[model samples]
Target: GDSVTQTEGLVTVTEGLPVKLNCTYQTTYLTIAFFWYVQYLNEAPQVLLKSSTDNKRTEHQGFHATLHKSSSSFHLQKSSAQLSDSALYYCALSASNVGDNSKLIWGLGTSLVVNP
Candidate 1:
C-alpha cells in the first residue's frame, strides 16, 4: 500500500518568519510523482508544486518543495510567511504512468496560519 503523511496538523508563524510543512511517504509503487496543493478558505485546492524528478526542488508562489526519492520525502518550505499564505496544504502522490490502476495517495493535510 502507498500513503502520504503530513506530521503537522496545524502550524502558526509570524509574518516574516520561515515555515516548513513536513511531508513524507511510504509507497510500493514506482513511477510516482508528488504534488503539493493549497486551498484557501472557501476555495478549491490548486496545485502549488509538483515533481517527479528525484532530488530536485520545485517552487511556486514563494513556496518550495524538494522531492527526495531516496528518502521518500517531499517537504514544503517558505522563506517568509505571509498573511495571505494561510491555507490548508496537502501532499499527494500519483502514479500517472501506472496504467488505469494508478491512484493518488493523499495526506491528511496541514493548516497554516500566518500572523501579523
Candidate 2:
C-alpha cells in the first residue's frame, strides 16, 4: 500500500527562525499526487501544497517544497519561520483521479511549536 511519513515528534524553535519538515513516501503506483496539509489548532487541515508532476516544486501560504520521485521525498521548508507557522503538518498522497478510488494517505503528523 502507498503511504507517507513525516518527521516525527515536535519541532520547537524561536519566533524568528528557519524550519524544515521532512517528508518521505512510498507508492506502488507510478502516477500519484503528493500533498502537504496544515492544521491550525482547532481548524481543519488545509492544503498547503500539491504535486503530481515529477520534480516540480509546489508551494502555498508561506511554505515551499518540491517533490522528488527519484528520492521518494517531498520536504517542506520555510525561510525566517514565524510563530504563526506553528501547526500540525501532514504529508499525504492520492492517486491521480478521485474517481480512481484513490483515497488520500496521510502521515502521522508533525507539530511545529514556536516560542517568542
Candidate 3:
C-alpha cells in the first residue's frame, strides 16, 4: 500500500527565522500525485502545494517545496519564516491510476508554532 510520511509532532520556532518540515512517501506505482495541505486553528485543511510531475518544486503562499521521486520525498522549506506560517501541515498522496475515487492518505499532522 502507498503511504505519506512527514515530520511528526510539534515544531516550535520564532517569528523571524527559517523553517523546514520533512515529508517523505512510499508508493508501489511509479507515478503518483503528492500534496501538502495546511490547516489553521479552526479552518478546514487547504491544499498548500501539489506535484504530479517528478522532480519539480511546488509552492504556495509563503512556502515552497519540491517533490523528489528518486528520493521518495517532498520536504517543505521556507527562508525567513513568519509567525503566520505556524499551523498544522499534512503530507498526502494519490495514485495516478486511481482516478477520482483515489483518496488521499495523510501523514500525522505537524504542528508548527512561532513566537513573536
Per-residue lDDT tens digits for candidate 1, residues 1-116, read 67899966899999999999999999877688999999999999999999999998898999999999878899999999999999999999997455658889899999999999
Compared with the true structure, the alpha-carbon lDDT of candidate 2 equals 0.86
Q: Which candidate is the best by TM-score?
A: 1
Which tens-of-lDDT digit does each residue in 50-96 have in candidate 3? Answer: 88887777778778888888898989888777888888999888765
Cα deviation at 98, candidate 2, in Å, is 12
Better of 1 and 2 by TM-score: 1
Q: Which residue runs does candidate 3 get wrong by more than 4 Å? A: 98-101
* lDDT (Cα, tens digit) per residue for candidate 2, span 19-45: 899999988765688889999999999
TM-score of each: 0.95, 0.90, 0.90
- Candidate 1 overall lDDT versus native: 0.92
Runs in model 1 deviating more than 4 A are: 96-100
Cα error, candidate 3, residue 29 (Å) = 2.3
